[model samples]
Target chain A: MERNNDVWVFIEQHNGKASDVSFELLSKGRKLAETLSGSLKSVVIGHNIESLAKETFRFGAVEAYTIDDQSLANYRTMPYSRIVNQLVDAHKPGIFLFGATIVGRDLAPRAASHSKSGLTADCTDLQISDVKYLRVDYKNLLLQIRPAFGGNIIATIISPDVQTQMATVREGVMRLEPLEKPGIGKITKIPYLPEAFDSIVEIIEQHRQENKVNLKSAPIIVAGGYGVGTKENFRFVEELAHAIGGEVAGSRAAVDAGFVTPDRQVGQTGVTVRPKLYIAVGISGAIQHRAGMQESNKIIAINSDADAPIFGVAHYGVVGDASQILPLFINVFKQKLK
Target chain B: MAINSIVMVKQVPDTANISGQVMKEDGTVNRALLPAIFNHEDRVALELALQVQDTYSGKVTVITMGPPRASDVLRECLYMGADEAYLISDRKFAGADTLATSYVLSEAIRKIGRYDIIFSGRQAIDGDTAQVGPQTAEKLHIPQVTYTEEVLHIQDGKIRIKRKIEGGYEIVESGMPVLVTVLKDAVSPRPYKARRVMTYKNAKTLMELEKLVEGNSLLYIDQLKDEYLSKNLYIRTFTMDDLMLEAERCGVAGSPTKVHKVESVVLGGGQREMFHATKAGIGELIDKLMVDHIFG
Candidate 1:
């Protein structure tokens, strides 16, 4: 079963439920399978994943491969990578996908190196197309599109010579559509034999702090970027959000510059927010930042540079200093709200 | 417990501040036109390694694989209190994807010999793959901990680490010979020391010394290398011959993935409307937003 035109997605699950990105990949994998005239399959590896396997059918997966074991309940580097590598070796898939989260980054590369497959990390887009390399024509090469050079450029990667082409996509980039009528759900169970090496690293303890900043559900979001300049200047962006009853968010640059926390970042690496109203202040709307908030109902951009990229996507763009424009806008907004 | 640790480092271009003339006409970034600097996350990783050495009686050795010019970052590593440094350079190792990069690095690490803990930045800025540390671990047949935020405890070849998960963090423990990829927020990296800088500024690799010898006949590369090595100023340099690497698996040939095409970013937005910066214009915009029921 090596090199089947099938598209496979690694269903990452914790506890008993699968993550959102896995379902999103399933939805997109179906489209890629159709483009190749093949089938979409999902691989769920975790304990008590029987229900999770059934859930993949609603996301258009024709088949689900399950490997459930108590020892494999939580994600351990050795066990997970070994089992996934064995599966990849056994089933020669043409394309494989994983969510570009912490788990995926840790596991995908091990599989890639073990299987000697071509794998691209943090891909934002995936497509199937024919290509020519070294004067040889290749059919149905998986085009892995991703941001590179610190998100300065987009690169399309291909593995014309490898049996399986794989890519890890960031969460929230793909659309998750549940089928009205679920697909033909079929689950194939694989046995897990615990190896001595599986217990090398132990999870001695864990703590979960639910992110207090839930920007996705916010109705209105006021976001800032590196252009906000400093932590003090960023207050203007927040003041406007406060005046308008909007949530506070920022770009990755803002997070890196210590203007905002990483949880409040509105970009590809962060949450994908489609708030009703998105006010972007002092942001250039790089493709990475824009990827997360582009779906907002209304996008208003305020920046000093009139030709800034944020203006391109903004429904209403104000060319001025955010420090000045934000105060005036907040004053007027408060007066109107009163 | 005395430990031997290795920190993988990289020199990346300042991708943010690069203005015009950085991108070539073909839509690819001209790295030569951009300013190259030590990657911040790797600096943090180096700092973590140094802290580990401070707590436990250990020496931290840093290594980076790049062109001859990459020695600059190695010198910076020495300035940051690294006990030793290694520069992996070879023309054949150019154009490596993460897979190939990890393969070559795994081989190079084996040559470097004997490390209890291998530390690296979670991912480099330019590639942002975050794959090398774990992939190299896999190649080395070792367990890995990625997205590590901090090292809670390290003693007697056992380490307790706090790593970031989806919405939370987990504390994991592993014995020696484990690979831990550090997050940027792990620790604030210390600044370079003036005394170390003064001493290591002339630190050069054998390749660099050869170039100096070529430019001036008075300088002999072997004598220069001997002098530096005697003074402990030689940054351990390795070529393809130094490591047991398959040429087919070292660089472009070893890379399974290829860049089909590169495109300049053009994130075009759906709508385009401009409002004046004037106070009256701001008021009009606020009124419009209120009518839309978003501002109010």
Candidate 2:
């Protein structure tokens, strides 16, 4: 089968549910498909994930290609990559997009490599350009735009020779299209046989702690930095997070200080988050750090230094020690909730 | 059985100190003014891989893709205890993002033939994309443990690793030939050994040797390569032909994505007003925030 016109998005999911970043990518894919006059297709790889295809269509995919093999039940790189590669090879798309999530990060590159295609990662922006044919001049052209250099510059890239363009976009930078009405999409299931390849690695088990928020999908986040003083001060930030019904995050500094594990870190070195409400406590906001969380819908910064760089990107600024202000804010929230 | 590990490293432009004149108007970074350094986290990754090799009594190979200047990092890798180093450099490999990069690295790995493990930093400091390691593992069809904080144990070809999850951590176990993307805190890269540094400092790639021969007719390029290879000082250089990579799939023609534009955004600070901790004032502040869409 020759597949040439559709745009494919890797729909990332966990625990039998869709990741928000998948929705974000689908939204972006919808716009791109519209620009290219093509259909938006999503590829989902998981075990017993047939029900999730409808949600993908609602998010903007016209069809969802699901690989529900038992080998793909877990988030291991090998099976996921093989499945995605098989789909891409079988159904050649003009463009492929993935959310730069942990799974997407692990899967997209491998698929691109296997396909021998180009991929741009962590793209904050994406757009398709049109070619104006001039009869007198006899000319045609194409254009692509994306942000570059720590978000310092925007670069327009064009490929005059290839049939497909692939990129992994960070989540929350794009908006998902609203589900207007229920739409039915076809799901084609593919078998995954682990024995097909000489399996070098096997996933033994998976675990998650109770009461921990998945920062990638959290709606509200309260993050602390080195300026939070010590490990104890991080608890103050946590108190505010709990009062706000949000998750606790930290900067690379906080992680380096042993205030939190590297997983909760929000920065270029950590996780990229786009929560609805991001409260940065004592974060000075280096560009590397802001690159991860600057996409949050609303950002409030609390720090002792008025000139802290975080205030530049913050929607609101509180000039006070986070140690004192966090507890006060938590108490205020508690009183208001009552 | 010892773990045979391969580490993917990159020599990136020191973008932290990039100045106005350091970048061309066309958006390409000027390599001259910007000192090329071993990517910080990749060094940390190399350290972790070396520690594993030391603990398991295996061999560690370091690989990088860049211009001839990339050999600097490869030699550093050898000095840091890498058993062998390969420099995958070609003019055709320029302008590659993480996606293209992982493809080239995977191809090189296939050429190197055998490996039980792979290690890379979470992301390169220059791009900060954190996509290459996982992408390479995906290409190689290997299971990957990303954001690894520590390797708990390796028993019976099953490697147990403590990886950082969203809020906490998960102990994941994968079998042999796993790709482990490490964090900075995983391990501090050991200092360069004086003997290894002195031994590999004379290491040269084919291009470098050609330039040396041009400067001195008495120095034969072939002889230099042989001597360096015998002394384990030569960076194994591979071309597209060497790796059996298709020309169309190896460079710009194989790359479909194009860079669109480059601009720097100078985010300015916002205005602020202080309020006393009065109950009424705090309520008013909350109301103002709600009005401004900051809170509801």
The best candidate by DockQ is 1
TM-score of each: 0.96, 0.78
Give lDDT for model 1: 0.87
Clashes of each: 3, 17
- lDDT (10s digit) by residue, model 2, range A1-338: 12266788887777677777788888878877777778988888887788887788887788888778666766766667766777778777878888877677767767776775666676656776543222222111224455455334556565434455677776655676756884677777666666544244455556656535479789899999999999987899888788777889999778878998766888754678888889898898876678788888878888888877788888766787777676667666667646
lDDT of 1 by residue, A202-269 (tens): 99877776668778789999999998899999998888788778899999899989999888988767
> Given the true complex, what DockQ would model 1 score?
0.73
Every model: Cα RMSD to truth: 2.0, 5.2
TM-score of chain A of 1: 0.95
Q: List the residue pairs that clash in candidate 1.
A: A2-A92, A3-A92, A313-B269
The number of the candidate with the highest TM-score is 1
**How well does candidate 2 reproduce the true complex, by DockQ?**
0.41
Which runs of model 1 end up more than 4 angstroms from their true locations? B25-27, B216-220, B267-271, B286-296
Per-residue lDDT of candidate 1, residues B83-201 (tens digit): 89999999999999888888888888999899999999998887778888888998999999999999998866689999999889999999779999999989999998999999999
Tens digits of lDDT, candidate 2, B1-296: 78888999988888766666876765556667787889988999899888888788888999988988889999899888888889898888877666667778999998887888899888886777677787677677677888889888888888888886643567777776778888887888899999988888888888788888999979988898998888777788987778877676556655566543445545655564554344444455556656766555
Worst 10 residues of 2 chain A by lDDT: A132-141
In the order shown, the candidates' DockQ scores are 0.73, 0.41
| Residue A218 displacement in candidate 1 (angstroms) | 2.8
